[model samples]
Target: MADPAGLPPRLRPSTVPPPAAVTRALHAINTCTSAAALAPLRVHILREPALLRSTAVISAFFLACGRLRSLDPALVLFASLPRPHVFVFNSLLRSLPQAPACSPLPLLRHFLGLGARPNRYTFPLMLTSLSSLRELNVAHSQVAKSGFARDLHVRNALLARYAACDPDLGHAEQLFDEMPRPDVVSWTTVITAYRNHGHSFLALATFRRMFAASVAPNRVTMVSALGACAAHGAVDTGIWIHQYVQKLGWELDVVLGTALVDMYGKCGHVAEGVRVFSKMTERNVFTWNSIIGAFALVQDGEMALRWFFRMKADGIRPDAVTLICVLYACVHAGLVDIGRKIFNLIVQGEYGFQPGIKHFGCMVDLLSRSGHLNDAFRVVEAMPSQPNAVIWGLLLRGCKDHGDSVLSEHVTMQLLELEPENASHYVTLANLYAETGRWLEAHEVLKWMKEKGLAKDAGWSLRMLEDRSSKCISDGNFMECAL
Candidate 1:
C-alpha cells in the first residue's frame, strides 16, 4: 500500500505516538522558524488524525503559519480539522490582520456556525477586520450580543478600531466617556484618535486629563502625547514629557526616541532633538529618518546631507522618506547638482526605491528653485503620474520669480484648467503679469477674478509718521504750540 503519510519512498510514518511524544512534537512545531521546516511534523500529525484533536497542536500550527504570514495553508489546515476548538479559531483570528489578502469575517462566521463561542480575545481579533464605519457598527452589535461588550480588553480593542478606522471621533469620545474604569490603553486610544484626526490640541488636553486622573501613562500613551505636542508645537509640554520619561527610567526605545526627535524638531528646537538623538543607545531606520527630517525642517541642508552619508556608512539603507527629506534639504540649500544625483540614484534603483509623486514633486521644486525651469518642466513631463497642483504651483512660482511671464502664462492656463475655481491660481497669474510690468494684463486678471466672484483680499501697508514736535525739539526749534 502507498504511504498514507505522503512522505518520500525512503521514509515511513511512525506509529501513533504517546501523548507525551505528541506534546514534544507540538512544541517543536510551535518553535519552528519556518513553514518548510514544519512540514514533516504537519504530515506526521495528518497521518495520525487523532493528534488533530489536541487544541494545542491545532493552535500551534495556525500560529506557525501566521508567523510565516502564510494564510492559505492555515485555511487548508483549518478545513482539514474534524472539529476545531476555540483556540484554533482564535489563533486564526489573530493571524488575519497580518494577512492583508484574507478576510477574517468569513472565517469568523464559520467559527460561529460551528457552535464555537468567542472569548474576550476572539472579539478583539474579529474587530480588527472591521475596516469601515458600517462594518464597525455591525461588529459592535456582535460584541454586545456575545456579552463581551464590557470586557476591558475587548472594549480597548473596539476603541482602537474606532480610532484607526472611523472618520469621526464622536463615537470614540462617547466610548471613552462611557468607560467607567478606563485603563491606560483606553486613554491612549482616545488620544491617538484625536491625534490621527488632526485635532492635536484635543489630544494634548486628553493627555492632561489622563495625567490628572493619576493613571500612569504607558509607552504607547507617551508616544501619542508626544506626537500631539509635535503637531501643535507644544515645546514646553514636550520637554516636560521628556523629563517625565527620564524620571520613569523608561528606556528610550527607538520608537519613543524617534517621537522625541520629531517633537523637538517640529518645535524649532533641532539642537535639542539632535541631543536626544545622539544619546540614544539604539537606533532604527525611523530614528535616522527623524534626525534627517529635523535637519530638513530647519533648512540645514548641509547637515542633512552629511547625515544621509553617515546613515549609509552605518549600513542603514535609505527608504523613500529619507530620500524625500534629502531632496527637500537640497531644495532649501540650492544644491542643484546633488539633487540631480539623488534623483538619478532613485531612478536607477540604487536604493531600491520607486519615485512616487512626492519624490517627483521634490525634484520639481529643487530644479525650479535653482532656476532650472526647463529641466523642472521636463521632470513633470517625464513623471509616470500627472503632476499635482503643488508641482504646477511650484513651476508657476518659479516662472514668476525668474520673470518668465510667457512660461508663467502657460503654466497658469494648465493650473486653471485643472482647478478652475482655485482663486490662488488666478492671483498667481496676476502677480506674474504685474511683476512683468504688464499692467493691462494684470488688470484683466483682476477683472476675471472679480467676474468669478473671487474677491481679492484687501492689501494693507504701514508707513512711519514722524512726530513734528519731536523733530522740532531735536532740531532746537521746539515751540510748545499746545500743551
Candidate 2:
C-alpha cells in the first residue's frame, strides 16, 4: 500500500514507531507553538500508518495544520483516510477559506460521495471558500436539496455569502425575502451589504425598516448603520442613532465607539467627535485614526500632530492610515521639515511598515507644494513604481502656482504626453502662460486646443432679474448688454 504521504512502499518509513511513541508524538503536535514545530510530528504520523486510523490523532493533526494555515498537508492527511468522520472534515472545511490556492467545492463533493452526511457547520465553511455568485448558487441548491435550508446559522452564512460576493445584492435580497422570519443577523447582513457596495442611502433606508419591524439593533447593526451615515454625511441621523445606543445602556465598546467617532468626524462635527473620543475608556488604532483624520480634514494640523504624538506616548503604534493623516496635517501646515522627517522614518522601516504608493504620493505633494520642484521630481524618479498621473499633475500645479514658468512648461509637456487627449491640460498650460503675461504663447495653446477639436467652456455672466431670480447670459448676450 502507498504511504499516507503518497510515497511508494519502498520509499516509506521501514519501521512503524511503537504505539506509546506515537502517543508522545501526537501530544507534541498538539502542544507545539509554531508551524515549524509541526514538521517532525507530521513525519512521525505519516510513517506509522496505524496512527492515521486513530480519529483522535488525525483530528489533532488537522487542527494543528489549520492553525499553521498549511492547507495542503491537511488535505493530504484527509485523502489518506478511507473514511473520515464529519468532525475531521469540518476542521478541514474551516481552514480552506484561508487558503487562496485551495478550493472547497471538490473536497465537499468528495466528502458527500463518501456517504458522510454534513452537519450544520458544514455548509457555512463550504460557502466561505466560494468566491463567485455561480459557486454560491450551486452551494445554495445543495443546501436546499439536503434539507439544511431551514438551518438558521447555515442560512445566515448563505445570506452573508450572497451579500459579500454578489455584485448587485439581487441574490442576497431574494434569499432574505424567502426567509419566513429573518433575524437581526439577516437585517444586519443586508444593511452591511448595501453599505459596503456604496449604497449607503439604501443601507440607511434598510436600517429604518429594521427599526419599524421592532428588531432591536445590536452593536454590529449600529456600527454598520453609523458607517452608512458617515458615508452619506447624515449627521442628524447619526446623532439619533448615538442617542438610541446610549438609551440601550450599552457601554461604548471599541467597535461602536470607533464607528461613532468616524461618523461624527466625517459629518464635519469634529467637536462632537473629539468629545466622544475623549470620553471613550477603550480605544484602538482605528479610533486614533478617526480622530486624527478629523483634525486633518478640518486643516487643524497642530491638533492632528498633537493627537499623533499623544497616540505614540500611549504606546499605540501608528499604522499606515495614521501616517497618512499625519502627512496630510504636515502638508496643510506646510511643516516641510516635519514631513521630511516622517518620510525618512517610514523609509527606514522604523515602525515595521513598507510605505505604499499613497505614502509616496503624499511625499511628492508635500515637496511640490513647498516649491522644492527638483527634489519632488527626484523623488518621483527614484520611486520603485512608475509615477502615476496624480503625481505628475501635482508637480505641474505646483510649478504653475509658484511661478516657475521654465519648469511649468516642462511639466506641462510631461502631463500632455501622459494624457494627450485631455483638453484640461491644454487649458491649464494656457492659463499658466496668460498669468505670466505670455499672451502669444497662451494664444498658441488656444489655437492648438481648437485644432484638436476640444471645445472650451463658454463664459457666462450672472444677472439679477427684476423678480429676484438669476439669469446666466452667454458671451454674445453680455457683449450686447455692454454695447
Candidate 3:
C-alpha cells in the first residue's frame, strides 16, 4: 500500500485501488479555496473509483464545502460515488434551499430525478426559499403531499414563510391560531411577521397570547416587539420593552442594544436614542445609519452632520444610505455650499463610489432652494444621462420659488410630457403661466388639464403666525390671476 500523501504504488489495480486514491483526492479537495482549484481535483477524483476513502466522508466533505460555493459541486461529487445513499442526497437537498438564487421547485425536481424522497429536513429549507406567496402555496402543497406537514420544524418554517409573505396578516394570524402545539420559535416568527408588515397592535396581541400561554419571551422576541413599538410610534410600549430588557439584564449585548437605539430614534426620543447608542459597545453601519436618519427626520441637521463626521472619524466607511441622509440634512438646512462640496467629493473625487438619483435630487434641491435656478438647471444638463422626473421637478420647484418664469415654463413642458398623468405637473405649469401674467397660456394649460379628464387637485397652504405661534391653513385651490 502507498502512503496516500506520497507517491502511487508501482503496480496499481487495473480497476484502481479505492481507499488510497480517495484519501489522496480528499486531501487535495480539502485544500481548494475557489471554484478554479476544485476543477483539477474533481477531475483527478472522478478518474478512479479509488478517489473516495469512504462514501460517507466524501458526502460530508461535499456538503461542508457547499457553504463556500453551493450544492452543484456536491451534486457532481455524489454523481461519481459508488453507492450514493440518502445521507448524500439529503446533504445536497439541504444545500439547495439556501443556495444562491436556489429554487425550491428545481431542488424538488432534482430529488425526484435522483429517485430519492424528501425527509423532515427537506421541507424546512424549501419553505424558507419560497420568496413569494405563490411559491409558498406550491411548497405548502408539497409539504402536505409528503406527509411532513405536521413535523415541528417543517411546520415552524412554513409558519415563518407564511408570516413573511402574508402582507395582510389575516392569513398568518389564522394559521397561528390553528397550530395545536406552537413552540417559542413559532410564536416569535408569527409575531415578527406582524411587526414586519407594520401591524404593531397585532404583534403586541401575539406577545400577550404568548405570555398567557406561559411562554417566556426570548431575546429575539423582545427585540422584534421593541422594534414594532418603535415603528408604530408606541413610545409607552417601547419604554416597557426597554425596562423588560433591563430586568433581564440583556442590554449589554450589541445586537439588542442597537435595535433599542434604532427604536428610540424612530420614536422621536433623540435623547433616549443617543443614550442607547452610547450604551452599545459594538456598533455596525446599520446603527449609525438609523441614528443619523433619526436626527435628519427630527430636523436636527447639524446633529446629523456631527454624527456623520464622527462615524467616518471612528473608521466606519460611509455607505450610500449614510450619504443619502447626509445630503438630505444639507437640503433641510439649506446648506448649498456644503451640499455641493459633499456631492463633488463623493461623485467625482472618490474612486469607486457613484451617486444615484437621490444624490442628484439633493443637489438640484440645494441649488434651486438657494435661488440658483440656472445652476440647478445646469446640474441636470451636466448629468451623464437625461434627468429623471424627480430631477426635473426639483428644477421646476426652484423656478416657482425664484419666479424664473422661463425656466419654470421650460421644465413644466418637459415634466408634463414625461409624466402626463401626474396632476401636480399640470398644476405647476399652470401656476408658472399665471405667475408670468400669461393669461392665455395659463388658461390653455388649464383647458388641456380639463380636456385630458384630469381635474386639478385643490391646493392648500400652511403658514405659522410669528406672534401667536398658531398655524393657519389657507385653501388656494381656486387660482387667482393678479394680472
Tell me the TM-score of each prediction against the true structure: 0.77, 0.80, 0.79
lDDT of 2 by residue, 112-217 (tens): 8888888999999888888888878889999988899999899999999999888999999999989888889999999999999999999999999999988888
Judged by whole-model lDDT over C-alpha atoms, candidate 2 comes out at 0.82
Native-to-model Cα distance after best TM-score fit, residue 16 in candidate 1, in Å: 12
lDDT of 3 by residue, 123-144 (tens): 7756655777877788888888
Residue 344 in candidate 2 has what lDDT? 86
Q: Against the hidden true structure, what lDDT does model 1 obtain?
A: 0.82
What does the lDDT read for residue 130 in candidate 1? 71
TM-score of 2: 0.80
> Given candidate 3, what's the lDDT at residue 194?
81
After superposition, the stretches of candidate 3 with alpha carbons farther than 4 Å from their true spots are 1-18, 33-84, 97-102, 106-117, 165-171, 349-352, 384-386, 456-482
RMSD per prediction, one decimal?
11.8, 10.0, 9.1
Model 3 TM-score, 2 decimals:
0.79
Q: Per-residue alpha-carbon lDDT of model 1 for 1-483, expressed as tens digits?
A: 556897556656878666985687687877788767656767776776557777777787777877887667778777777657887789878776532675666777777777778888888887776787777777888889889888999999988988887787767788889999999999999988899899999999999999899999999999999999999999999999999999989999899999999999889899999999998999988889988998998899999999999999999989999999999999999999999999999999998978999899999899888789999999989999888788898987887678777888899988988998877677676655545545455556666766777644422100001133234334553233122
